[model samples]
Target: MTINGDGIDNPYGKVFNQTYPGRVILSESTSRTSFAITVLQSTGMASDKMAPLLQMTLSHMSFALYNGLAGPITIFGPSSENCDEARDPILITDWGHRSAFQEWERELTGNPIRPQMNSILINVIIDHILVGIGQRYHVVRHADPKNETKFPASENGNYWIRTVPAEGCKGSEDGNELDERQGFLRYEPEEKNKPQLGNNFSWWAFGEQPLWLNFSEPTIMLLDEKKEWPGDYVIIPAENRDRWVYLVITAPKTNELGNNRTFISLAHPLHLHGHDFALLAQGNDSSQIDDPDNSVVLKFDNPPRRDVALIPAGGYLIVAFKADNPGSWLFHCHIAWHASSGLALQIMEREEDLRKTMTLEKLQQVNDGCKKWNEWFADTENLWSQNATLFQDDSGV
Candidate 1:
């Protein structure tokens, strides 16, 4: 089918940093309507252990979120994460564990991951539905991951994903051209040969974090159109407006060695430049694929209306939103790097916005300039689908 823009025009380096098994889907949760959120943190494995540590936890959580969200997603951690703050740093559990048994880990793995996590373990299961579109917003944290003992302080604030502002102080009519707005300032890595600055003063130790994600407020909830919800084979919006709509997402797993791609999910608050949506289904989960009623039949004619939908790593999701606003607006993963690596896409009126922003003549000219974009995209996307160096029997990964 027509997947969201990927590869050249939008090459996805990795799905939230893991080797994407496939296009991330926002399906509806079946068992009960709820949000399946998986929150995890890894102590530094060693000095300069950022890469390996992140890899280990991401893969672990991706798989956990994928599986956990099939049911309810519960997490135990410092109080920094809100159980349902919608934009807080971390997620709290539903029930509070007052004892010394790393209650948070218990909520996640049904057991404690550590022996000394004695904070009040909370238990939280999504009690809602999985629905709506999640417009990707960027998050530019206000602090550092290593400095803060809690989240948020650890999380830089939201940084909405936007195009490079017009040049030479353009768009003066819409906005002042000579404006000294540093926020809209764009940086080009290519200028300096696109140097990889991870440890420089300009670069950060745990730098290059996402500056946006899951920040859509007026979200249109996608429901199970077939009347079957979380029980259906996959999650999606309901056919009519008579079923569950809200949904919470979780991450899928990858292997530390098998899938080394970075899948870091930084929550970015979405600040729509144009409009907003009605917040519906908040947090919930879906049914297992094997369930008889867990099948989602989509209706493109009347898709669910939403703007932002969190693409949890572990599980599949489905959401719908009406294309009301008219402009060359951005629709990305909210994670800047994710967007930069190919998770970015655009939703515009083919004729009104797209054409206005890029006239057919100019659009054609641009495409002509890069005629081979689509072709190269396919091959790059399918690179890991089937590795090439293997023998006949071992032809693919």
Candidate 2:
């Protein structure tokens, strides 16, 4: 029910630290109730390091519960002496061991439940761009004045997302902080207090605009005279319904300022909402970038599919899925810190169909929510800047 380090005490004084219970207490139940629990590690662990242990634990637990050996079981301690030698033998000797492997193998060989054969494949490349202050701190994905392009483009009506580094970015440049042009968007309570910068500067700023508007047609607002246009945001056409989409996410190596050394290199867990995707290819090499036929070997024959996949540091991850579900889906880094720093985007699928499906009641409910938010924010005392002690560190993801 809990991870191994659930209840360990910290001798060293660490801020905001607390101990968790070793096991979850469940009340005795009848009526053939079923329950499931997932134990996750705080720090990111490699699959090779944890998968075998998880497999063994799950196998043993299933065997014990099904064979009526679960009653009055003693939870084993961490020490070697307190280890359950009796249960260790059951891992290999259990009757279900062979069946479990057989089931897994069968599932692996079965025809993969994938998008339709004629589905359109969209290629998206995500870059985790970072500017490091030192070995510890990093300023991620800030806007650059020199980069003319806001987002990358794709041919053949496919999708492509690219991170364009800004000229004179901090950590590499003489100036250490973002000036008016580079600073992130901050909500204005009054128009008189608004900064002199134009809307163009704000639109080009990374993470400045919301992908979808509750009442208006979803589109990117241009800086030149406040015009709405089809920007870099992905729009899944109605014709692509039930069609396949191939997304290739890449994280290129970032270089340091004077030395041109590798500035940041870390794997990121990318999560996509509303659907799971098959992990076609992932590796820690840049040569595999976009060369699916030669550079990398893809697992098209029944690949592993999941909602979250790791985009390796200085590498790439290729995933595929069907565009059957029509909604605005967010694709972003799973890491809280990275996502807060503008490592996210939205995919607007089947907009016409979605608009047709929206009802008056639904629209009113959304309007009501917005009205409540406005009412809440109208209280000047509750303003984020008003509270000096309060820190708005998160992106409110």
Candidate 3:
């Protein structure tokens, strides 16, 4: 891959790739550092199955790490833990440790251990190194006079939405909320609301199976604040396709019902499938943009744009994206398990326009694929089925 810096518009005098390689303090390669990751095998409760023991252990451990610490890359926003200067690399020491990692360990292994060290190395071989000069970029708000648009503060009508984490029940007996199973839990709020934790609760929009393939009945629904939360489905009207929509995801200390099931807040690297969003604001504390006392400051103009942005543990993230794409787009936590457990939602923009773009051939292809999948799933000899019970335990995405 070729790297160049000639296209940069250096306004501020900050370090950047002005020529080719950015200013390099050292050009020589250092000795390789190697490390080993030791996995501890342990026996679980009597009811724990050996088949899923390893997978569960790894999943929980991975969640613990991701939910506990921040990385060296700087996050865009005004916050205590984030670097003072945007684009600057955060110190490894500044990535503080949270007790949540140990909490997860103790719950899984019956013991808590010290935090493990982590690092990544990229090796590129070259005879000589070239350095570039520094460039500058200023942070400007949408209403600022320095901004090209010079939009008025009143015109900055950023559409705001919030979500909270909660534990949900997959199935229950006798319509009892207390008898609900603990297998299905959501790490992020489903859509704009918590997934109903009840016996009657099915996946909010698509039920138990995938819905995108069912083109005949595309899920088209708008956010409703009255009746219930829109679980995994939200519609963006065609008129607002050009407007900027903002979403604020905060790691609350408690669930929607004010319950303490999730005692510690976890981190999530939120990702949007269809489009890159501007990370307008973020903070170390769990605060929303609408919070009256929230000290988090938002940068509306030329904010750092990204497809994946980190939501720090016990913190908040505010992102904005134009609803120009007319299709069903997924916005969810980057963690695989977290997403499968329902920490995701679909943003169906301009439903009518999106439907018009779907061709009959594409619809037939999707239906054909679904038909084959259904047949495979129902086959008696399929490995996914055992004793007439589907072996798939997690939410069938």
Clashes of each: 105, 2, 2
Report the C-alpha lDDT of model 1 over 1-397, residue by residue, as the tens digit. 1112211121222233233222222222222223222232121111111111011122112222221111112222234543332232222211111221122223223221222211211212122232211222213344323433343431233322222322321122223222232232123322001212232111101122211112110011111133332211111222222223222233333312112134333222221222233333222233332356754444445443334455433343454333444432333342222332323322222223323454567556545534443354335443333653311111000
TM-score of 2: 0.43
How accurate locally, in lDDT, is each candidate? 0.26, 0.38, 0.39
Give the clashing residue pairs of candidate 3, or none.
Answer: 12-136, 14-135
Model 3 lDDT per residue over 115-207, tens place: 331211112211232111010122322332333345443234432222111233121223332211212222234411122343322221212
Best by lDDT: 3
TM-score for candidate 3, residues paired by index? 0.44
Error of 1 at 276 (Å): 4.5
Worst 10 residues of 2 by lDDT: 114-123
lDDT of 1 at 187: 30
Clashes of 2: 2
> After superposing candidate 1, which stretches have Cα over 4 Å from the reference?
1-260, 264-293, 296-306, 335-343, 351-353, 357-397
